[model samples]
Target: MTISKDSPDVSVIEDRRLSCGVRLLVESNPSVKSAAISWWVPTGTMDDPDGDDADGLAVLCAGMLERGAGGLDSREFNDGLDRLGVIRNISVHDTSTRLSASLRNEELPSTLELLADMVLDPLMPEDGLDPVRSLCLQSIQGLVDQPPELASIRLNHLALPAPFNRSAYGSSQALESATIEDVRTAWRTRCLPEGSIIALAGGIDFDVAADILERRLSEWSGGSKEMPESRPRIGGDEHVEQSGSQVHVEMAFDAPPLCSSDELPFLVATRILGGGSSSRLFDHVREQQGLCYDVHAGYLRRRSGSLCTIGAGTTPERVSRTIESIYEEIDRFGSGGITQDEFDNVMVGLKTRLMMHGESMAARAAAIAADFHDRGTPRTLSQVAREIDELSHRAVDDLVRSHFNSKWASGVARVAVGPSTPFQPRS
Candidate 1:
């Protein structure tokens, strides 16, 4: 599975499938002495069984993996990696769980074995369960004091359907009631090789990496189960009243999915709206009107469906004005579209980001894995840059009109966390 070289500077991408069903993607760069690896499986929060007590099982499962594996205690396992100078991270998303690490290229073999053990032979000890469960519950409880995070969570609950709406931290009730057996069951059911991908970037030979992975994971086998799908529930207002001087408001609108043709256009539109300090939202709402402490909009690219979210932190006294101002900017953007100058600037910015990611092995490894998971094919940095360059101003403008015109008002999901909900219905 050799992918043709797409760019002069980019190495050829090698995609392979092991007998056990684990997919391997490697981008070898002989110029560097370090390697970054990303192990991805379809064991995300969405895989948790439908029950209040199961909300955070996926997260708990990931945590338990780090506790011990292959008969080694947590301390011994971590010390082994430390001796190899490995930096490891594990995160569970809505649709996937990613285990990643960066280490010297020479330590690849040992690192691979350790990672395989964590995934395939996790101990999930009964004693470890209570501590991790308590941590997860505390994380959910900690959200109460974080207005912005609370608002984002509430927005997702209101905008997305069940399971897909489940948070990475799960809920307090779920964590409290979840037993060790429940987490073990969820892990066995969801963590399979068929839907998993292992990505390696930086200084490593593709053949060597593939061989290492095959030897480590070939005996591990499990069938992958499909996650339940649901459409987003857009256009509604939800308010969680809290005692605070500042109000946190989050607005979400439907956008193109990862598989849609309009994905790039929507991403460009998000940047123009609020990608950075120079974006319309920041320039208008914060810099000009001085209504918000901070404001930004981002395009969340998801396999189920994409979303454009705008969030603002502002005084309760100014929440209404801040929301109205955001709406005004959206309307203006929909009607006016973006200018050629803005297009060029955004294109440059996007390319700059792509180039920077090219320099980081970790970023490249994670990117290829995510691309394969989301699109079934890995993309080169050059491919992404070309796509961004090809996007015309007119096409973006058209997308903005279609997704953010008067339709934005009708299709928006609003969540406010504060002492009062000051926003009124759009007439």
Candidate 2:
């Protein structure tokens, strides 16, 4: 275990790998009276044994973990957490399934016990399985009316490499075929200790948290799992026919993955393009042209790479122009690069955003766990601040210039969900 201190009075960050092969990250913020815990088990969809057939299994298992555990049924378990005034979320992502909770410092010990049992001794009750599965199925069915969400899902499916591209929503066939026994097996096989991360923040002591986890997870031990490499596919345009007055469009272009040299530059670039009302997308498309109510760009990071995604919703009449205008803005921005004034402004904005994010104990805790997954280490606010401070104007501009030459234009993926096919009929 190594320790890193942020300041004399702020928080102390510690990263430790326990004998059980679980990594524990604790950032003790003595100034705050609450604590946040983010636990990641390697039980995400990527680890599904049925491969594509296992899409929704990881998500369903995540939901069932909440139903009961450690001798308590669903109601009793939730009642326990409620009594502690703990706010928690359990969700499945591409990399892993996570249990995140924030509660008062005094409730830390008990909360950890309940959460630990969720991962270690979950009941996976047969009675609860149907409800959880139905919820999962309902969520997938609900997507039909959610064109924007559906468009994003379709875009990710078309753009990202296989397995990574699979939706967390289980396919209908997969969800129906998934028996309770299979979910039990998935949990047992995938919820290993080696590759998991337990991150804690706010009013916590690293040694104390570690002791609690070490005892509770003493019997939890196993090696991690890995997936095979598949051929990279250059994603193209896609359109889904839906009866809607407004067309939802999503476009994705290349960006660097976490731990890459260009990660910071790309972050700055995308932020400048569509991060907020202050960005180019909002300025040129929404406000100036009145093309849509919203037009924004965001950076989506996966372990393999990243995407600078731009989305806008507008009428059928404006859909084509909206898409062309977005690309025009992208081309102009890429061709001209960014001004030093706006670049400097974006730098400050990022620094401020980072500081603000650090204020929330839960957000900070989730970030710590994410850093461990992405970079194999946790970074303090000051460390991240220094990285932001070190970002150069030349670095960002040069990266943007190089991007347009190959990746963004050639492999750009566009998806539109509307009555008309602005993205073509896929013929």
TM-score of candidate 1 on Cα atoms, chains taken together: 0.95
Over the stretch 1-427, how does candidate 1's per-residue lDDT look in tens digits? 1121245545678988898998899989899999999998877988777764568788899889999898899999999999999999999988889999999999998999999999999988999999998888788879889989988888887777766877788877777888899988888878888989899999998887788888888888777677687754545898898996889999888778887888888888899999889898999999999999999998877776667899999998898899889989988888888888877788888777787888899999999998998898998876776677677888988888777765565555889999988767657
Report the Cα lDDT for candidate 2.
Answer: 0.84
Candidate 2 clash figure, as a count: 2
- The estimated TM-scores of all candidates read 0.95, 0.94
Tell how far residue 304 is off in model 1, in angstroms. Answer: 1.1
Report the Cα RMSD per candidate. Answer: 2.8, 3.1
Q: Mind giving the per-residue lDDT tens digits that candidate 2 earns over 165-205? A: 77888787888888999899988988899889999999997
Off by over 4 Å in 2: 1-10, 49-54, 405-407, 424-427
Residue 39, model 1, lDDT: 93
